[model samples]
Target chain A: MSYMISKATSVNKALDEAVPLCEPVLKIREAMRYTLLSGGKRVRPMLCLAACELVGGQDSTAMPAACAVEMIHASSLIQDDLPCMDDDSFRRGKPTNHKVFGEDIAVLTADALIALAVKKLVTSTYFGVSPERVLRAVLEMAKAVGTEGLVAGQAADLAGEPMSLEEDKAGLEHLEFIHIHKTAALLEAAAVIGAIIGGGSDEEIERLRRYARCIGLVFQVVDDVLDVTKSSEELGKTAGKDLIAGKLTNPRVMGVEKRGNIFKGLIQTRWFR
Target chain B: MSYMISKATSVNKALDEAVPLCEPVLKIREAMRYTLLSGGKRVRPMLCLAACELVGGQDSTAMPAACAVEMIHASSLIQDDLPCMDDDSFRRGKPTNHKVFGEDIAVLTADALIALAVKKLVTSTYFGVSPERVLRAVLEMAKAVGTEGLVAGQAADLAGEPMSLEEDKAGLEHLEFIHIHKTAALLEAAAVIGAIIGGGSDEEIERLRRYARCIGLVFQVVDDVLDVTKSSEELGKTAGKDLIAGKLTNPRVMGVEKRGNIFKGLIQTRWFR
Candidate 1:
């Protein structure tokens, strides 16, 4: 826990410096910084750094990639909360990005952050990571953000559309597809990219990818359960709003009690074993 | 003209292959293709390929970079035409992206195209472009897309805000600032990245960068002038809409005749010489 706190602190500091309020586009930068610096658990970046260190890399080597994932995560959050998407009013206990900055600026803010993330990862060659590894990591980041990843998941979720299934079935399979692409994909990329940057063997990188995948799905399942169990204030976001919007969730599909059982079962099988 | 036609043909083919209508994200891909395939002049990609060849690199070596630039340009156009932005009803003789695929899908389409551009550039290491050059190219692309480039230009243009000027002056200087960032920056990046991929020396790359910058600004000035002079049918887009929206443009800042003179002077000094 102490290790996590220290890493989170470093990440927060790094992010703050990444985009300072400078001349000639201060508004866009402000919107970006506001969304990025808003408090979160820093889970994805921590996952990146941990994977890097577990593979014998220095913390400094993966810091940029760590920050990149966080920026991408922040970008996704802003996009998800837009009026055209989830239409959420609050996030992390504050007004959503579009609510604070107008919709146009909010959109541009998200786009800029994604570009910044790519820039940071690719330019980290100064940090002693090889260009080959940096290229691979960037490719992974792009995959996680694009059609095969978050966009597909969000689109499927919004339209409740079937994806690559033989039948247009709406079941656990569909739910898993949405969660895997939308939530787990970036987390998987985070760990995989860290391991790659650390010069881990292919086998090691694959192991970390699987580990992150399990953790990501578990995180989403728990989030779905909490949406029903917690208050809006408790969650620091609009709780039960997913249900109001008729969005699918673990609790909605299988009662909250069963979802808890599934969470524990996942831990027992994927982690303990 | 034949060289231009051949290069644009190759770019179009490469782009079609880059984003096939694959399963599990058909809708997103449709939106992306709908915007991307709509005919544009393909000027940026041509500049990229031409720069690479001039630097002694094969056209095949820079084709991916060329496609990537086009994708980035298409993404910006989609965002620019959104209702919250310019609110244009038509682009490239068809309904704008948001008009055809709803605002939500249009937004996601733009985001996906950006990601796809990065992915295409990095993964093109298979083209035998060295990792060092690819990394450099990716960094350049990011800079052109982020706050210092397209985003900054769009934000300033939308808000009519002065950028880095002493007295918030709004004239040719402000217009120049907007055009340089919004248009010239990406074109400069395209040429620079092409030169890098072609293994050009620093001097060669810098020279091409300046050359592309001049061309980009000229392109925008001519576009602004045409917006006033051409009919909607002639332009294949909404004509005279800039004046209708009271958007600041080269013709609006200086009369159309002076803008034309500037264009001729630019060609004479930058190209013909």
Candidate 2:
């Protein structure tokens, strides 16, 4: 628990320095800082930092990337809450970015964060990591965010109802697709980038990649369960949105008990052993 | 003219290949393909290629980055035409992206293009450019797209009435600020990246950077004039949008004739000489 706290603390500090409020464009910067520095669990950054340290890389070498993953996450959250997208009013117990910053600024904020995220990773070379690894990590991060990753998942999620009604094998595949691309891909990329930057061998990187993928799926499944079981106040965002919107989720398609068992089974089978 | 045709031809072919409209997320892919393949003048790619060749870099080496500049440009256009932004119905004589794809997909299209642009530059190593150079080019592109560039420009452009009211020196400064960041930065980055990829010396890269900056500003100023002088049929977009939106353009700040002379003077003094 202390280790996690230390990692989150450093990640927050790095994020603050990365996106200073004092800027040539103060309003947009405020919007960016509002969303980015808003406290989440910092799970993605912790994964990135842990993977780097596990592979013998110094924290400084990976700190920029850890911050970058969080930036991407923030960008995604802002976009997801936009009126045209998920249309949620709140996130992390506060008004969504679009609600606070207005729609235009909110849209630009997401874009700026994405550009800043890529810039953060590319400039990470100053820490003495090889340019080749940095380039690879950039490619990985891009793929995780682009069509093959989050974009695809979000699109699928938005094209709800038709697919959600199918409780067959195809529905399971669709659900898995959404979870993997929308949630797991960034998590997987975070760990993979950390390992690559930390001088891990190809074998080690692949192992970490697999581990992170499972964890990402597990994370989404748990989130799905929480959306079903918790209230809006408890969850810090609008809960039961998935059910109300008729969006597909593990609990919805496979039953809450079954989904919980699957989550438990994966955890015990993969991590404990 | 033939040289321009050749460069644009190769760029078109490369762009088609880079964004293949295949399965998985067919809708998003279609939206991406629609905007990306839609005909533009291809000026940015031409400048990127010209800069590369001038620095003795092969076309093959810089084609990916050249395509990347266009992708970023396309992303900006999509976002610029959003209902909350410019709110234009027509772009390049066709319906804007959001008009065709709906707002949700349109937003995702811009995002996917950005990630793809970064991906394209990062994977340019296959053309044998050093990873160091690739990393540098990526950083340049990111900066051009982020707060210091397009995002900043658009933000200022949106806060229109207040800045537009200041037709004094400060207003001119504001207009220049918007033009440089919104328009010129990407062009400068394009030329700079080309020079870097083509293995130009720092001095050569800096020279191209300056040249591209001037050209980019001239492009916007001319565009502003055309908005006033031409009809929608001639300009291929909603003509007089700047006037209608009260957008701070060159013609709005300075008389059309004065802006025209400035454009003519720049051409005669810079390129012709």
Candidate 3:
């Protein structure tokens, strides 16, 4: 299997382990699988695992952080696919979480998934890391998901949802902030958090931050490219949805040449394992 | 000032002390204050203060958790008010976060605020409780916010966003979960977290939980009644909005006789300080 597939499968396994027992509610089980098992690439969770293993740790210890990162990512997607957020019909070659599950269950499922991830962090880290470190991680992750990070980006993204050319076209900074925060912050958190849990030094952690930043930008560029280059049949997510949504993407920023240059420069630096 | 007011003010003061040196992004700050200072009843944070005091502790150490509860609460509100979610145009007599800050900034601001609150929990708890306890507090708060708690409720709520009478009809059970998880769970966390920070015994913590549950339910009940009796001109939040939104409420559940009974029973209880 390709590294991505293996990593994604293991991350899915790790996520299964990390997900708390759903309250045996029909709604929860249905909604959760709708989003989780819909088969998107588990890129964020893989980042956590790769970072953990890079520093000589395993998913056994890093699983909670991994799950937390993915949960935040997944929750964002569930919301993103909502008729209000992204409103795209398909994700990972399947109907979006809200579309399949209905909106009420969709929102609740995302909320529950986020809760499960955080709870796991508390439980797993309790015996593994120093209380202070664990506390720090929880706080850090929370902040990562907070208003300034993904949520803020999401709000901004949603604000720009309708996509009038006159407005969003000029708001490139706004769109970048949204992308960086909404999508990349959680990805970065997975890596940084994995390093933290794996006992990487502060300097190592800083390097990992740079690593995550590099990959985050690269990952997003790849996404922008994929969204444009791929067909809806080629990419699970709707092709060119960003353009349709009027998202201020790098491609949208500098067009084909400039965006390609940035993507190439960053991707060559080896963010991927 | 009422006890709630004094407690809220004090927590606000400590929040100033405990928060990181905010460089102050204008959009972010505007979004934060637009809701935080918008004259909330502060019942949740007040529960934290009362719990801290009740456990013979001071507000100095409980500040972060107090602020965190409020931040968490605020983030949820922003999410809850999304066009795909509750779809409310106004909350507390003001335009909802998305309506005012515009969706993008409002969402980002709510997110940033939540992250800041987590940061507070990490740093703030050092003054009183152990780091482990602070982590524990954060874990609890996360659980409340996510699926099993508020987020799940929200998902269910959103699922019902385009409700038909044939569906759950905002059933009493569903609404109970919504209100409890969305409101009471956090309130309970604020209470227990304050006590834990104060070094309360397990017995005291249990007592606080019971107290929290009672007051939380009472608070929700009062809110339900207020939706009927109070005018939006005075209450800020529009009256009958719950029904308009198809919420499963106490009035809808218990009818007049049972509603009055529940309220009376709560008022006579010793849960309130």
Candidate 4:
């Protein structure tokens, strides 16, 4: 836990410097920072660094790849928070991008951030990384966010919530699937792509992938727990909004108390062992 | 022109085949195919193929890049047809994807098509092309679609309208800029990236870039002309939607009568030269 905390703080500092450089358009960049700079666990970048080290991929290239993951992750969240989408007003314990900058600019900020990620990744002076690897990373990132990944999950989550509840497994089942694609897909990409960028061997990539899948599921499980356990002060966003909105999260479907045991059991599986 | 047509028809047919195979989800794949088969001039893909040929590239890689460009173009058109965006019911003289598939599924289709583009590009089994080159293609596509390219233009366009005619320049000044960024950026990417994949020299890539830029701009100029002078049967989609929206476009700003002279001049400068 201490190690995680220390790593996150270092990442937070890196992000502080990185986000400023992403100011392609001054107005939109301000809106991006408004939401992006808000404190969070910084899990995505941490996963990148962790995966990099696991495969012996320590270098400056890691920062660009790590930052790229964070940028993509940040962009998706901003888009998801749009009024036309989830209509979220806050996230990560602060006002969402749209809430702070209005819908037009907020959405644009998401766009800018995603572009900045690719732009930075491609242009980085990482030797022998090849335009092919960079392109693969870009494509992977796009796939992670596109229909089959995060956005698809959002669509499913939105469509499923109207019909699911305690008495029905169908809604919860859909929501769980949504969570897997939406949040977990990118998290998985963060680790696997990091491993690839860091030039990890194929076996190491797979190990990191398995490890990432475990953590991605855990992160969502934690999110589910926090949605019920955390308050507005703790979450920065509205507390219990997911529950109020009739989401089929783990806590909602499995019951808040049951969630802890399930999370623990899953992480303790043989793979993690 | 006849050669271009033959080239386009063959390219279109290949894209039509490749698109469905890449669809990760069945329904989303069908949704994507529905709009893609609807057809435009296949301008983006043609540019891609043209660049590959210009660079004297091999067939093993060029074919997939051609398909990828069309997919990106198809995805953009679907997004533009959304009720929350352009709100158009017709495209290619037929009902838009949202009208046929419904908005919920329509959004997903666009999302799926975009992802499939990445998948197809990365999954290519070609040589002399590294993963690095493929990754660069992804970044270019993302940069084209993400905030700095198309999205910013779309946002500007959305914000530009609803102002007084006096604000027309401000409103439409950005319209062309948007179309260029949103539309032409990817077209240029299609050309430039295709050359890169083909193993073209840097000089060859630059030459192709110049040619592609001219064509891309001309393509938009012709589109502006078609939206006015042509009928629904001729141009497909709504012929006068551009005029109806009071959006700044070639016919609207330059006057329908003067477009011939202006287009001629534009061609002479950007193309004929």
Candidate 5:
């Protein structure tokens, strides 16, 4: 926990310095900062930093990629909360971005953050990372968020809500698709980017990619379990949201006990490895 | 016109090949292709290609940058037409993206296109351009659309609408702020990216930047003029939208004749030079 906190603090500081309220678009900047600064676990950045350190890279070398993943995460959350999408009013115990800034500014805020995330990676001159590596990292991050990544996952999740329980169970393939693309792809990219920035060999990068993918799936399974067992207060979002929304989740498909076992098995396997 | 048509044809082919309807996200890809492949002037890409040629670079080398600017332009237009933004029903004599795809899918389409635009530049391997140049182009393009660029211009444009005419006129600096950031910045970036990809020297890139800035301003000023003077049929968007929306425009501040003279002077100066 302390290790994660220290990394989160560093990521937060870098993020704070990254986006400032300035002229012409102070409101959108404020909107971006509002959601970004709102506290979360900063799991993506932590994973990125961890991957960099695991590969024998300097922490400073991976900071920009770490920040970039967090920004992408924040942008996705903002978009997901919009009236046209998930329509959630609260996130992390605060009013969602669209609720505070109105949908127009919220949309702009997401757009700006997405662009800024890419720019941050490309313009990180202070780190002296190779341009080729940075370019690869940017590509990884981009692929993670585009139609083939989070967007597709979210879209599939939304499209699946109206399915009957039997259909959903039969649609396990589709469920895995959403889980892999929506959640795991970005997390995998986060680790891969850190490895690239840290100058990992291709073999090491591929290994970390697979490791992060497993961790990401475990993360989602745990999230589904928590949704059933925890309250909104504990989760910092509406608990049982997947169930309420009729969204397909691992627990919904495999039953809670089996899901918990799967989660535990994933962690134990990774731990022993 | 023939020169522009040839450039547009090549750009269209490249853009069409750039985005394909693949698995898991065909809907969003269709939404993106709908807006992107929809016929427009392709002015930004033309400028990019022209600047590349002027710098003595191969057209093939600058193709990716050219397609990127058009993608960025398409994204801004999609976002601008959303219900919360310009609320337009039509663009270029066709239904706006949201009008066809629904707001949720439209938003995702815009987000995906923006990410893909950056990815296109980063992953352009055929040209053998330096990673440093591509990275610089990506940064330049990203900056052109973020808080300091299009989003800023858009936010200011929306905020200025409710102001009294006198207040808006008093805010001419603010109006220019919108024009420069919203319009000129992307155009400037387009030329800069072209020059960068084409391997122009610092002086040449700077000159192209200045040239594109002038062209962008003239473009917006002409747009405002056409909004009032031309019919909707002629303009392809609602005529007098600026007046109806109370949007601050060059004609709104300086009067149509003076704005026309400014546009003429801008073009004439560039032509003579």
Candidate 6:
């Protein structure tokens, strides 16, 4: 936990310095900074740093990639909270971006952040890593956020809203698809990119990718359990909102205990290794 | 016009092949393709290809970057026509993206396209250009689309809506700022990137950049003039729509004839040189 905290602190500082509120577009910049600087667990960056260190790399070597992952994550959250999407009014205990900046600016804010994330990765001259590796990481980040990854997961999840979970064989498979693409794909990319940028061998990168996949699944399952068991206050977000939204979740498809056990088992296997 | 047409055809083909409708996110992919494949003049791509050729580079060398600029342009148009933005119902004689797909999908479609644009640029192996040049082009594209460029222009444009244009020095400066960043920045990027990818000297690149800046501004001024002078049928889009929406434009700042002369003078100087 302390390791994660230290890494998060470094990431937050870098992110702050990276995206300042400059002139001409101060409103949109503020909107972007408001959401990006909002406190989260910084799990993705932590995972990236951990993967880099596991492969004998320093934290500075992975900082840009780490920051890029968090920026992408922030942009995703901003879009998810728009009135056209999840329609949430609060995120991380603050009013959502659209709620504060209006929908037009919120949309632009997300777009800017996405562009900035790519810019940061490609333009960062401090990489102790090679340019080819940096380019590969940029490509990986792009793929993770596009139609083949997060957008695909989101589209499928929306389409599956009408599906009946009870007595449906395809429900479990569909749920897995959503979780894997929506959650695991980015996490997997984060770890793999960190490893690549940190100069890890192809085999080591492959191993980290697999490990992150397991961790990503466990992260989603735990989220499902928390959504069912925790209150909105406890979770720092609207708990059980997924259920209310008629979205398919692991705990809803299977019992909470079973889902919890699966989460625990996956975590143990990945972490112990 | 024939030269532009040939370049447009090649660009359209590359763009079509770049973003195919695959599984899992077919809906969003369709949404992206719908807007992208719906034809435009492909002005930015033509500029990129032309600049590349001017610098002794082949068409294939600049194809990916050309496609990328168009993708970014398409994404911007999609977002600009959203309900919370310009709220336009039609673009290029077709219904806007959100009018066909829901607003949620429309937003995601734009987001996906932006990510894919970056991906396409970085992953293009046919680049006769060096990796450093490709990376520089990617970085340029990023800055062109982010807060300091398009978003800044957009936000300022929106905010300046309530400001009275008469007898205001700031209004003219603001209008120029908006047009320079919003329109000229991407166009400049397209040409500069093409030149870089084509292995142009620093002097050549700078000259192309200046020429592109002039051309981009002229393009917008011509658009403003056409909005007032041409009918909807002639323009292939809703004419006088900017006036109705209370958006600031070049003709709105100056008279139509004055703006038209400025546009003509810009084109003559840049092209005839």
Q: What is the interface RMSD of each candidate, in Å?
A: 0.5, 0.6, 3.2, 3.4, 0.8, 0.9
For residues A21-84, could you state the per-residue lDDT of candidate 2 as single tens digits? Answer: 7778888999999999999999998899889999999989999999899999999999999999
Worst 10 residues of 4 chain B by lDDT: B159-168
Better of 1 and 6 by lDDT: 1
* CA displacement after TM-score superposition, residue B195 of candidate 2 (Å): 0.7
**Candidate 1: which stretches are off by over 4 Å?**
A161-169, A264-273, B161-169, B264-273
- The lDDT of each candidate is 0.88, 0.89, 0.71, 0.72, 0.86, 0.83
Of 4 and 5, the candidate ranking higher by TM-score: 5
How far in Å is the alpha carbon of B44 misplaced in model 6? 0.7
Task: List the candidates ranked by lDDT, beginning with the highest.
Answer: 2, 1, 5, 6, 4, 3
Q: Model 4, B72-171: lDDT tens per residue?
A: 7887788777776777888887889978866657765665676677667766546557765666666677777766667766666665554555654665
Candidate 5: C-alpha lDDT: 0.86
Number of the top-ranking candidate, with lDDT as the measure: 2
How well does candidate 3 match the true structure in TM-score terms? 0.85
**Per-residue lDDT of A75 in model 4:** 77
Name the DockQ score for candidate 2: 0.89
lDDT of 6 by residue, A82-193 (tens): 8888888888888899999999899899988888888888754566566678878888888889886788777777776645646455777788788887898899988998
lDDT per residue as tens, model 4, A29-147: 67767766777777888888888787777746767777778887887788777766667887876778877777657655665676677666665436456555566566667778777
Against the correct fold, how does model 6 do in TM-score? 0.94
lDDT of 3 at B189: 83
Model 1 C-alpha lDDT per residue in residues A13-82, reported as the tens digit of each score: 9999999886668899999999999999999999999999999998888999999999999999999999
Q: What TM-score does prediction 2 earn?
A: 0.96
DockQ scores of the candidates: 0.88, 0.89, 0.50, 0.42, 0.81, 0.79
TM-score of each: 0.95, 0.96, 0.85, 0.87, 0.95, 0.94
Candidate 1 C-alpha error for residue A248, in Å: 1.4
lDDT of 1 by residue, B1-273 (tens): 897898889999999998898656888999999999999988888899999999999999999999999999999999999998999999889999999899999999999999999988886588888999899999999999999899988998887632332332456667777888899999999999999988899999989988889988888988898999999999888999887777778767767767657776677764423
The better candidate by lDDT, 2 or 4, is: 2
